[model samples]
Target: MPNPADRNAMLEARRTLKMAQSPHAYVRGNTAKFYEWLAASPVSRRVPTGPAIWICGDCHLGNLGPIANGQGSVEIQIRDLDQAVIGNPAHDLIRLGLSLATAARGSDLPGVVTMRMMEEMIDGYAAAIHDPTSGVPGVESDIVRSVERAALGRRWRHLAKERLDAVEPRIPLGKKFWELSAEEREALTTLFAEKHVGAMILSLQGKPKDREVRLVDAAYWMKGCSSLGLLRYAAIVALKTRKGRWSYALVDLKEATTPIAPAAPGADMPDDDAERVVAAARHLSPYLGSRMMPVRMLDRSLFIRELTPQDLKLEVDQFSHGEAVRAARHLAFVVGTAHARQMDPATRTEWLAILEADRRGTLDTPSWLWESIVSLSGSHEAGYLDHCRRYALAA
Candidate 1:
């Protein structure tokens, strides 16, 4: 159990942070309590048979998005792992389930209808992971909307040439975000910028020319509303050997915390984020964490892996009525898989039933209500952000 004092303090901090217009900022300090929660629960830590990758901790509708691939294929896949922990299959599901519930509250769709979608998604994942042969008809354990490799690789080159707002390296921001926190900037720049670039060149596979070697470049990027004030930097590591030829590596560092709920806020316990991911991956699904590299340095949690382009999802506002439901259905399976992955077989079965029940009740609702929820959420988000901004200026 977490200390009583710590829990109270976190709740108060969350209020302050929320008042500062930072709903997008992730701040889950003392999240270790979640691990403790899972342990005490009746969930099993056994891994199912399959290839696993590092599970995203905070996977939800908003977190899924597109990434460019080295091959130019714009694949869709899962992203975000602030609360990610190495544990069971379904840790992220809890977040997904609640998000769906909260999301539904804002729309005109009856709560029952949204619940049905959630149920379908959950059952889909159960069948996919447990009995692939059975062929459950849904999306779970799948990277939400990731694209293909060859295509992503092709898209990557094209994107590189164009000006990407955040994902692609097109802008020439020569280190202005650094002024915000000079101490953090110096510490990170010294670690990642110049030194890592030199090391990357030697890691090159074949020999080339020294004349071919190019110095790596570094720049600060400002994006992601939740992570707005947090630190972020990227470096272009191009490799060259004794012969004149070139290859490149992309490395980045960013704030790893999640947006704080109005009920809680503050700097997250630095090491907890990565630890949660590793522990959950180790316990719930080893395959997911296989290629995922987890490390923490300079009091920050970091995960290193190939930036996947296959992962993708459409923006929420972009979706129409039918499209939103489709999105809900897709998210359902992913979240279900996450929950079942963590809990014991019995618990999984029970959750499956409850979620199914939630789904069936929605069989008769009007779809317009669903759309209304999206609007409500947006309004609430705006209202909350405004409230927080006032305090930020005060502080």
Candidate 2:
């Protein structure tokens, strides 16, 4: 059992309020509930266990987005690995499908549109698995293209304004960033002093190997939905260049907790939560993975990474029929590419064969994916309404 002291009642209340806002918000915040339902569902036994590769265990649509690599090249991929584990690839597919379907419902799009999106999703996923080297298609969607443009045009000042509330060099401790306890602050200072941590800070800009890195400011970060009660901190570090100039980098340190998503039997992964998240990121999202470091902070397993302005999450509150189809295909391709790269040729072939099978009659999509989405969507909708009712009564 988790330590009761670690649970913050205030944050938990805030999280509940956020989840009650909408069905989509509820879906994003309740990953554990989804997994619990999946375990008990009849479809759980029928879903094929593909190659046991690292999967984004909480793979909702919001978790997939454009992230900048160390070289500053931005690509769409899974951005969160909090619940990542070496598990069945089918879980990712079903989770993503459910997310898209829920978004369609939120947008007031017709049920048929959701069905078509699922088909496009399977088509796109299969394409990537077949040709791992090819890039994801359907960037023509306005949402993705606009985000790409915004990410490309952003710089340090943009990041500073959005995250730090100013172009200043220090982190402000207030609503979004609470004051860190003295011990937590001391731990952060000690963490940045380590050789490997300093190397990671300098590696962000490919700064000279010997550049002096110093922790400028840090604070308790009040962020995220499901991860609200966990230990999270934001640290600002100054990198001194040889030219006697200094540049700042924002580093995010988040506690890694026991994942609710079950790993495959006999899966080989580090026992430490932080290491497990880093390992999965390396396999599933090399762009974000290359920039992350697993470390120990405050006697807890935590992962740290430099935050780039280009790192953005996908936000889709509404969708058109055409947009839904295109987005589904594009996003599925992104996820499939991540899963495909980890498997050998023979494993890929076997997985693809499994996915291609069980297509009903003239339908291009697999039956299991469609059925799983339908069932999960209904389950989540019922859960969301019940949650809202309880929240109302509490109010």
**lDDT at position 123, candidate 2:** 81
Question: For candidate 1, lDDT tens digit of each residue in 165-230?
Answer: 344443455322222245544654455434443443333323322324342555554334333444
Hey, what RMSD does candidate 1 come out at?
Answer: 10.0
Give residue 67's error in model 1 in angstroms. 7.3
Question: How does residue 383 of candidate 1 score in lDDT?
Answer: 54
The prediction achieving the highest lDDT against the true structure is 2
Q: Per-residue alpha-carbon lDDT of model 2 for 1-395, expressed as tens digits?
A: 12335447667777889989888888888888789878899976778889899999999988988899988999888999999999999999988998889889889999999998988888888888998787846445677767877898889999999999989988886767777778887899898989889998788788976888889999877786655657888999999987999989999999999999989999998999999999999999999999999998777899999999998999997898899888988888989999999988899999988998877654466877887888888888899999999989998
The TM-score of predicted model 2 comes to 0.96
Q: Relative to the true structure, how large is the alpha-carbon lDDT of every model?
A: 0.42, 0.86
Q: Candidate 2 — worst ten consecutive residues by lDDT sum?
A: 1-10
TM-score of each: 0.54, 0.96
